[model samples]
Target: MGPSITDVPKSVLQDVIIKLPTKSIIMCKSVCKTWYSLISDPAFAKLHFAQAEAYPMVRPVDRRSVSRNLYLVEPEDSSGFDLKDHDCNRSRVHMNLSKYKLPVCHPEELLNYHRNGIVMPSHETERKVSMKITQIDDNNNEVDLGDGFAFMMQYDHNSYNLVNSCNGLLCLSYFFGNRPAAVCNPITGEFINLPHGPKHEKAMTLIGSGLGFSPRTNEYKVMRILKEQTPDTNKVAEIHTLGTGSWKSVGTARCSDSELSFPTCVKGMLYWFCDKWSGCSVISFDLDTEEFQSVPSLPFEDGYDVSMGDLGGSLCLCKVESFEINVWVMNDSGPQKLWMKKISIHTGFSRSWPRGVYIPMKYFENDGLLMFNSRLNAFFYHHPGNHSPFIYLKLREIKYSSSEAISHVPSFISLKDILVGKDVEILNINSRCAVLKLPGETEALSLVEENASF
Candidate 1:
């Protein structure tokens, strides 16, 4: 025998497993049954995720925690990654990335601003909805997420929305069975359905919804806005707290004819661009208080094509004013302060909206550079306001869809750990090899329990 069964102390063993990264933990699962049990414990994943937060940037995280500031491009074929942009002299760098898939009606990204490399694609055939996932590494390799079979593998539904993603959790807008929504950890192959709410008449149907995290309370909340689409209708807001499993009325918000914008979380509030007001402007929703507020108007006329985005840990507004794109940041939080215009660049546009537009994607912290990507070009601008004013910048012959591009550092915070599981399944499995299987195939996470050993 290699060693006695009781030779090692259980306390010491516990300490060792919690210190390893996600990759190491996955490989070690196959080493032995005992090791798999320890690493697979939901308690251990929670402990490791919580303790790992204190890790400093100096330590080399060999684990793929996502690139610091990488831009994602979707070629017309929706398969291979392109590298024609590496010849630039800006601080932005390019790597040889491979292909991945987005599971939406449009070839657009399902979630944005959330820092996790995991992406879920849903394919429905003959009435059953199959959940397929892929992980895009820094190497551009599309890896499988975990070792679990299809979720909602057999269900009678045709319509669903890939609602919102924060941390490593995905919020499905569709009501599974009778539930209002389903919150799933695509990484762990574990999902919890939210309790169902009262069905409304056709007049008060749901028009828009979003999810956000409160750093202060350390809780995740889903905000679903229901509207009648009538001229004098008042929009209703329903808030769902993860642990409560119930959606509570957060009071109705008044603003007719306004459309909801993509949700952006900052500090403890959610911001979005909307025409739901007299003028098309940004709106704010508080995470802690569950209240809604309208942000002050940006310094622009009513005719400019404008959008809101998160830049450098703050809320930024981009407007196509005159022949240049004006980049502005909110100097203060909440509904106060004026929009500060910082960078201006001439990109050959006029009063009309161009056939394509450049959306701000990423901001480099180590260096002061901002990058934006459009349908046919990827551009970067260095801040400090001392460089040449929109001169002959570098060009790359890469092709991406006109869809939205997003960038963030991937994190390993488990959805199960964050939302404490009571009747939930905490299977001892790994995410790296829990590959997403094709239609009519059999696989769960990475492997079936009987065949855990590779």
Candidate 2:
């Protein structure tokens, strides 16, 4: 390399690094400490993220080659690559479900757009005594969600629920009995309490709750839907705006015996399935207006075993039938009739694993690969283009009984940066953490003297 190129200025170097593919950036981080410092900086990360957002066309993954060697980028060019797609708190609600010998995927971990597939291999069931969160990154590599995140919540792993996710923020509810909710940036492990809404004299099963962001108002919100049974079912709506302390009433809606799955937020609006006596309809609540309306219903019949998910960046509904799961993506959000049946995946009986249900955890819109787990420690990537073969991906290290993976987007935005009016505190994890401090942060906030060294 010539001296001019070798001696590239820091500003010029920043552009070069930002231009590299996501995997290359991680590789470049190890080239030298200077490169690591530059690439890992919060400001640089935000700039790189903005650049990636500007080019949003996701490219599909290649089936012929599973190795990183055949890595594909946008426009089918790896040179000027555009590899598409794809936290926390402590007091860690580390749920180790290995002892039960049952499937332990949590619907609550579905907190964001790029849902992470949490897994614990079947072999290592002993780690439940010391629970750990296993998360899969974009490169198909697994990362642990350690630090006091689970412990900070002070709840048994079974009681924690991931409410909603936007941009990169996550809302989690703790409910061994109490229904206290909190919003936190899993990357930075910075969280603030959301004021408790209408108190319950006795513990009750919450209908569901969601977290969202309103770009127009520049605010984040936590919406909880409470249901009471025994005396005919009735539903109550309560909302808490981030940066604001208390939750306010959003009025109430009549409840039905039919099932309503968790909410998925899109463009500042929250949507959930409303299975009423009338029919199955998708009910949406505008975050900015705080108004509720029924826009559209599922394309299928009322009770067809349906589940909602974020397919890539679009809102998707998955209909699970006998052995095939039909995935429908809402191509155009403007009209209710624009649902395009993108793909159908066959999950029929197999000689090796019969009757094991494989659920899609992360949908790679660009590459057409749907990541899933049929059982504990068992993970596979299903490419819709090719149905006959399923590519197996393995999770190494940290084997507990239960594990969770949700769609996650790594970001430079800190909790303090988003929560403008509120005070922020970092949870002290009683365990060791691999990554500490928010990206671009100096001196770890609330530095626990013993475990400060990352």
Candidate 3:
């Protein structure tokens, strides 16, 4: 070698390191003190996060208590993370389950089995789905792990629910607003508590909430929807800026439901599934302009269970019909072709549509796989083709009533800087390793058991 990497200039090294994937950058922190200091700098994190891509993020619930652990799924090929703007019309699947047959099981039976911490024998018949999970406990201030691992951050003593994900930051709120909500960077463990929404005289109830980032102003904002107990059942929306430390009245909401569907943030706008007297439609809110608009709804008339999500920077809806699922997407190009059919997945199991079905979460283009979760609190990757195979990833032994994984990009954007003088607590995530064996895999992968916090 002509010269060592250490001999490289600081500016050149920083430039090269920032281009690597988030997992590679995290490993760079251990090279030496100089590299650690350079990588840990706030400026470097901001620059690197800008270039990062969002991946499937899951927080496995621990029935004993709340969990603060986060899992980031990375594909074998880094380019597989590029779910947006790809030209591949077909995909090649990795897990070989051509001979494997999916067992016929209903959603109710799966849910009941999961509730009792029992794994159905049918789910164990095939080992087509597999992932390598590693658990690491870091004494350092930052969370550092090798490939195919998760990011960790500490949370408070109470339990919190993940409202939505925006620009690498997760919006967390207490169940039914028992306590204030917060926005946090799970990687850095820096967060700021938000004040409750504007108080109202007419008994108000929390309906919905979400967090988003404003690209125009470079600010993070939180929104809350409250329904007043009046004859008309009026609803009001409020906005809260991070650094400003206060809430502002936006306007009346058009939704009439006491509890609206979960919201998804895509490209700085928030979208929610709204039920109207006419039919089902999607409502969108702009973080920059502070305006709400109605987007097109699904084509079906009724009796289909649907879940809305942000798939590859576009608004995606997945509806279940018997054993088949329809994936529809709203293109951002123009108004002429608003919603169109993207893909159709046949589960291959001949059974009646259960209470809960497969809901598309995120897509991996290079891998030709679509990642989604079922109401049974498990995640599966679907590869659309003649045979339509699915690979399942196990999150731990924790039992949950329902589970969902959001498209989240891991970043180091600090809340301390975003909130300036506000109280931002830096936390330490507790970590431990467990064992999980797949149906046919030779080697077993480690599972992550993380402590609770938001």
lDDT of 1: 0.48
In order, the Cα lDDT scores of the candidates are 0.48, 0.49, 0.59
Each prediction's RMSD to truth: 13.7, 14.4, 13.1
lDDT of 3 by residue, 397-441 (tens): 444433456677778766766663455443322111112111222
Ordered from best to worst TM-score, the candidate numbers read 3, 2, 1
What are the runs in model 2 whose C-alpha is more than 4 Å off? 1-7, 16-45, 51-159, 177-180, 200-205, 254-260, 273-281, 302-305, 347-367, 374-377, 384-388, 394-398, 423-454
Index of the highest-TM-score prediction: 3
TM per prediction: 0.58, 0.62, 0.71
Q: What's model 1's lDDT at 145?
A: 48
lDDT of 1 by residue, 330-449 (tens): 888545667898667665544432433455545444333444444323344444443332211222322111223343222344555576335544332223222433222221111001
Off by over 4 Å in 1: 1-92, 96-164, 174-180, 184-191, 229-231, 276-278, 333-335, 348-357, 366-374, 377-403, 420-454
Per-prediction count of colliding residue pairs? Answer: 16, 37, 1
Using lDDT as the measure, the top candidate is: 3
The residue-by-residue lDDT of candidate 2 on 188-284, one tens digit each, is: 4355666556554433345657777787888878777766555755667778877766678798744454445546777777777666656676766
The TM-score obtained by model 3 is 0.71
